[model samples]
Target: MGKYEQLAKDIIKNVGGKENVLSLTHCVTRLRFQLKDEGKANTDVLKNMDGVVTVMQTAGQYQVVIGNHVPDVFKDVCEVAGISGGEGSGEKVKRKFSEAALDIISGIFMPSIGILCASGILKGVNIILDMAGLIPAASGLGQILAGAADAMFWFFPIILGFNAFKKLGGNPYLGMTLGAALCYPALQGVNLNVLGFNVNATYTSTMLPILVMSFIAVPMEKWLNKVVPDVVKTFVVPAVVLFVCVPVGFCLIGPAANEVGAIINNVIQGAYGFSPIVAGILLGFLWQLLVMVGCHVLVVLPMMMGLMAGEPQPLMAVVAFPSFVQTGAVFAIWLKSKNKKLKTIALPAWISGIFGVTEPAIYGVTLPNGKQFILTCVGAGVIGGLSVLLGVSQFTMGGMGVFALPAMIDPANGSGSIISAVIVAVAAIVIGFIIAFVTYKDKKEAVIENKEEKLVKGREVICSPLNGNVLPLSEAKDDAFAQGLLGNGVAIDPADGKVVSPVDGTVMTLFPTKHAIGLVSDNGAEILIHLGMDTVKLDGKYFEAHVKQGDKVKKGDVLVTCDVEAIKAEGYSMITPVIVTNTADYLDVVEMASGTVKAGDDIISCLN
Candidate 1:
């Protein structure tokens, strides 16, 4: 098979086929997919598949974590799915929903974070062991663990170089070669100095510059790989380019780039040094927003530098607030909401937040609705500002969260700073909760009154078409839906059954297996209900229908019915989804309480 053909097949198989995919997007480390049916995408199948390291469904996307070559994988997925790979607009999709995605984001960073903590503990142990004259610095287990722990930093360039190359859709090993050149032994010994002063140059554990360069290099590699002809190009072009490019990069590019990074770091440190309080507030509000854009990595480079330099960086002191505040804000929403589905997601987000992964809380909960995000930010900023002014500090480098408390206590500086940080964070949560509570008007009262007064015309909102659970559409696993790539609506927890309209509307279309149904509401809003994951395996056996395409459905109308228990027996979730396909056309899509909803129930109401 042709290389392109093989690549296409690999992407298709992991994504659950052309039909299962909703959309695809890419970031530094992942190819994010929003799928029509997440269950249809076989995790085990994808895991065992070649070129795949792990499949992570996080932040409401089925992320095929193909290690560093995720960009290539993403390109292949786009090719196979016949979709264009564009700088995706941050639009929201309405057809997908996910609980696992949120959980993964909130939890995925834990293992790495735990290892980081373990390494810190070991470093401290080594310090004590040496001070007490017990073991030498060359102790085997200690040295080995230290190396393992520090490897991510020591060789960040090489790792990211390989990753960036793959992401740009090129020869991954070639990318590694480029990274190796950056850290070459010959280059290490070379130096550029000014006025007899040794220029500070250490790439051993530096971040950002090399990785940034890799982004440029990977695309170059791909272009070179494709345009260069086979005959003498392989040996001649590569060898010549290596000889020329490596020197140019180190002699000219590397020094300038490294200096720029240093300048940025110094500027930030200077800002913090000027007024730690201001730094705390500014970073607390903006740090998460930067994280969303992937620019937060730039900020982190400086923090890593501070750890290496053994200095107190104000950013580190305030870093834990945003993560904690997101969890707090989400917890408040979960408690305030009557939605059982929200509770399920919020609970996991809360737990994950304690471990320092806030992606889930940020993407799945905070950003979806504008207000809560603002509240969380304000809360985090207030807390962070107070933390800095109060002289909070972290002695060790660790993930930011509850588990990170140990590292925050500097034995030399004492534990006062750690206590102050927690106090500030908790206070911020309380204030944020109050803000959120005040902002959340009694929508329930409005819903109850509308029902009692029959204000809901024949236009009663429909239940989710599928039967697993009702969830926020923003949390969909499919990218087309998660990033709002598709038009507005909500996602259903798909389970087998006849899909009913949530409102009095014309039937748009029913999918072949009766696994999905589409409708146009009286308001001209589009909606879809997709059934259980891979329940397609049933091949319409357990599916039943009362209406055909174009049939009219009133609120609470009997649209379809299936043996819910049988669907469960097949290992599918009974959770159902109710969607509003054209939510953008309206001012707001007011979802009903997020629990066991019934047909003809007011699933969502719209405002113009």
Candidate 2:
């Protein structure tokens, strides 16, 4: 069996089974599923599953993010379920027209961002080589390599057309055909008289022209699909769709949309003229939100690409601020978190966010706490505004995060954007750290209780905190507990939500969310009882705490009472995890029993 075989099976089961999957496709990090019925799938179960990062619904598709190893997992998932893979079915669902357009644009362009950055890096490398005299720009070797790097951008219309057509549910061939006509060599610099008006347009390396033409090709292809018979559909569809779209494009949409680009550029420049600092701050502050709603790609990414066609794109410099801000906030969570669940998510999220992925941090850690999310914006905005005012510039289009620095390095002037970028990143981290530490205070009793618990010598046996069926920690749903990453533990599917003290101990810490508690036994066993996964979002509405930090209790003493049905009704699980948090302090933490248990029953045996 493959490593992810069970995860694949579980994911398929929760996503309404293999029968519910109409078709499946995967990008670098997510499983894009076109489901027969979106409502039938259990998003909560999928979100809490091990080996899954998070679940997102966007662009009329149910997306299950599987992180960097998604390709291999996608293959096993298809093979296990007898699925014929490739996403296409159920594409007719309607969304708001503007939102639909943004979805189509982002879906097509996001896949190419990796290659776009790679090619830009190569172009930057060539320029550096030429300037340093290590290689001659006029040489044939340099020319071939440079063309290799430059070709992806120069022919973007065709590349974008192929993906865009798939998104719009049109014949991709027809879309590519129209894109090719826009870049036909014979018409490269020609001005044509159409409809008693002269039109001059060339769209080889442009942004708007290709997008406008591709979207227009969508409805035109749909009309032709209905009229053209399947007997000769393959050739006839492409021929008719292109023949109509190409002429109409050059004569009408091209000229009109070309002027629209100029107008948008003018509007953007006018905004920047008022205060470049304010524009930078706004972009940095809202970039993550824009990405969440699927607008950043359509609005900001294209603008930078369009600007890069002629000269340096300064906007690219400010956009990099969000990556650092997001990572910094996660770093703060990692440093400040006492809840092992939060700590586990924070560490991995911080690592990925540094590399320019924010979904995990935003969905799993920061966004759950309103203050944490706002702090990221504050840090990003302050630094982003200062960067623009200091004249930080970028010479090419590329990736985000630390890798984006290559584009900012201008050998010609040595403007120190690289230094400023590093300083800004450090500032963002510091600001984020302060916000988390200040906003979420540590439990006051932890300091007082830890001093006494440390004086005890031997390990202590802990009893069950609830009347429930005992489950191995591996079955906890959440990876932080399931994988034993938060130390040795056991879990429960509680019959009732009454939580009691497992040992004669002091309550070391009580979460503000009222969903978790920490205790240290008199004999020195440090334990954590965490309620349902991600239940902290409830903010204590369904839970009533009978004890506070530093309160003393014996076995079977009720610590809290919760309305379990309220949690379940609100789409959260009722499985509870009981973990020996300070596992390193003992020789070994062992589970004493499994399968069935009652409150005060023996469950965890800690050895000194």
Candidate 3:
């Protein structure tokens, strides 16, 4: 009942009052949900909701992109909705076969990636030290540090088991027990007989073994839960499960998983061996496009890890630097835009993209602008292919380009991988920058406001745009206007049909019919002054435009003059809705005065 309680409740209500939510989990920046009905979500309201960056339905999961503080929000969301805040994984979501496969891989492996990345980074640090002769690999200190760094992968099944169990809604320790059984130290030794079966294969640091083990073990755990009595469940579940699952796991599951692993390893190795350049080009170019079409950034996770059983990973190398391409595109828009809204989204998104967060850039900037996104993709593809040609490859999982530099460094040899990565990143950034900067012509376009740009801070006092009797937006006959979808502000029954500027700023848009004018204030709020319901039908018959698009105007300056009597005689609604098109940017929009006033009378309070 604190900071995020209300927000959580609002989110739940809008997501179909918790009934529609089949499962819930969260990643670093997203609230990933498996919903019973995707259609039930009030996506518009959630997207407009404060604290939410955007709403996305991707890879068969509904993702609410909430940067940084998702964990806290996710906890509140679970508590408020009375659903398991399970690590957003393992639900049987409805999706295409490929997407379903990717979803399962991501959902199961995602929660444990933090451990993998941490271990990888630690190992990378040791690599730097060990290679530089700062620490001898055989020394006691080196051994301890190496153990600390390598533990995650050395006994990966255990870590994966814990996360996968939580994801599958089973007792996590049991999953750990199963993992330990697969990677049991004794099993790694020469021929070991377990339960009259000769166990030969060792399952260490491989993906398929633990997955196959769980494919059998998790379901077994679920079956056990149903049949086992409550009184004996405590001792019986583990006692019987470990007894049966362990030996069967060693004899059956482990061997099958190894075979699958070998097949996948061969396939990936063969592909890279065939052509790294082509693979890199395809991955780099399509990665952002995939993201645009609802593929999560981690969609290539399985491919990267699966390939890691043997081959050097080109997936990460090709994909990492391309983010700079998106950053570059947004930066271009920021530099070129005259409209405050586009500039605002672009500037922040561009800054965030440099540090390896591209959602802001993709969702906020490029994706909306067709040409700009295409240019960014072109730059990324060229740079990405060039990176592979320069021998840029990732040795371990890490963040985007600069952040992934350490991971890119070869652990076995002090190779110039990081050097190559740096060059690739720089090239990508430069290429993307040039492409986006030159390709995007802002001459006439810069003046147009980004339709999706929300209102800015300030502009709290909105003076009446016309001499009119103020009314709520509900007075409008049109559903979109009355529902405040266009924005929040009061409708007015005009005393005089002269529409004046509500805020001192540039007129960003003037509709051809002269029925509406969009303005950007000095402070940044976007105001849309719609003359009246269906006024466009009059086709300038009863309306006279006083300002052209892109004209800078002050408050009280006449925007358009209309004849109320003439419009009424023509059958158009006389109620003019003076709406702030980006009202979602503000905390509240209050009607300050309902009855009467002259133009420039502050009638609405746009609270922040």
Candidate 4:
């Protein structure tokens, strides 16, 4: 069995089983599921499951956050659930128009994003090497590399056709055949008189025409399948699809789609040309927000159409710095935070953001803090507007972050644009860092406690595990704890780092990180003590365990010791939560301590 087989099975079971799934797709860190009925999924169980990060329902996609290794889990899920081609055997549930459009766009493009970005990077590098005079454009090595870099874009119609047809539930090879015919060399600039109608258009590097052709071909192929004999159906359907699609595409779709693309490009360029700075500021400020909601791809489609039609994209250039802006904010957090766990997440997120992947930085650090995310957007807007004022624009699609700078180098315009790009990126990072560092504040919880009550008979008394001020679990920064999703509990702003046993019990689980421990009391009470919020990311740093899993322990026995000052210095909150994981197993769990607590003082009473 695969490593994620069991996890995949569990996910399938909780997500209303395989029968409820309409389709499944994935991007980077999430498994996007389109379900027949969203209400049937067990969201809470999936959230608390091991190996899962979180779950989200947005844009008509039930998203399962599975971290970076989501692809592996997605594969295992498909295998275990008998899901072929990521589509389930059921009629798709009707979705809102906007949601359906977003799903269709994502399905068509997401599968190709990685290769597209890699190709863009290669093209950018080739341009740099040629400009440097190290590899002249006419040199054999340069020509070979140029071909490799340009092939994907030059033949993009065929690629788009294959993906589009597959997404629409049609045969992909037929789509490819139609796309190939459109790009045939003899057809370029050819004027054909078919019933006194002139059909002349160049289809190389085009997008919209093939997309239209694929949509038309699916229904045509379906109609042919019904009339054709079974023995010759395969060959006849494909033959008919190609013959009909190619001419219709060239005669009608190609010319019309080209004009439509031109109109859209002209409008965008006109608006951008009217006030470059305002356009820049607006795009930069809203780009990340659009990305958060998965609507950014809709914006990219028109820009891509324009780029392929030989138009400059100043708007994309302006919005390019948002990732770097996020990087800057994460850097500030890394420098300012004393929490080892947060610092650990921040550093890597910052690094990935620099490489043009900001999901880690956005979801992991900035968005969670709220203020820092806004500061980064403000920084991006300022830099984006400045970039326009300084005359920066992109001539071609390129890789993100630092790798995108090469696209700013307009061979006809000298080095001015590239210089502007560098200035904007550096300024964004510096400004974002300064703004976030000065304005960002760590979360602080107010301490409040109920009046003390004496433990009564037929109840179990659990003592305080650490010296601390009392805090209600409802006020915890973590949603799973604050909402009581993990079970009823109260939190503590620890005055000391020592974690002692609260009852005579056996250690049920000791987390490898040493940041949490679980015990089963002799009186049938289950207790879980978590040392800090997100402290698991610390990976055992500054934590020492005195007892291992399955060890027998009595009340007041020291179970673990943490470096209080060191953890605080690292910027981690030492607000610990002692939860009764099996809260339903008892009558009620009540708080017994008020205001402050010392180890060995009764802090909770589990009523029988």
Give one digit per residue, the lDDT tens place, for model 3 in 1-608. Answer: 45678669778877877777766766657888777678888785576544677788877778888766678898899889876665432335466887666556656776776667677677777788888899987889999999997777778888888767776677889889888878878778468776677768877776667777776777877888889999888878888878987777778877887777677667776887798788778777787877655464454655555634645676666778878888777777788776444565577678878877787777666765667777787788887789889987778766553566777887656578877888888888878778877777642211223463333344367788888788877677764466444556788899888889988899987766788778888877777777877666566788889999889999999999888998898888888887776665665565667788789987766766
Candidates in order, TM-scores: namely 0.62, 0.70, 0.72, 0.75
The residue ranges of model 3 lying beyond 4 angstroms of the native Cα positions read: 87-103, 131-143, 194-198, 294-299, 307-310, 443-608
The superposed Cα distance between candidate 4 and the true structure at residue 73, in angstroms, equals: 3.8
Model 2 pairs in collision: none
The TM-score, computed over Cα atoms with residue i paired to residue i, of candidate 1 is: 0.62
Cα error, candidate 1, residue 442 (Å): 5.7
Worst 10 residues of 3 by lDDT: 443-452
lDDT of 4 at 559: 100
Error of 3 at 333 (Å): 3.4
Q: lDDT per model, in order?
A: 0.59, 0.73, 0.74, 0.80
Clashes of each: 35, 0, 1, 6
Q: Show where candidate 4 strays beyond 4 Å.
A: 1-3, 49-51, 84-86, 411-414, 445-608
TM-score of 3: 0.72
* Stretches > 4 Å off in candidate 1: 1-140, 168-170, 181-201, 208-237, 273-275, 288-312, 332-345, 359-371, 392-400, 403-442, 446-502, 508-512, 524-534, 539-608
Question: Can you write out model 4's per-residue Cα lDDT over 260-292, one digit (the tens) per residue?
Answer: 889999999899889889988988999888767
Sort order, TM-score high to low: 4, 3, 2, 1
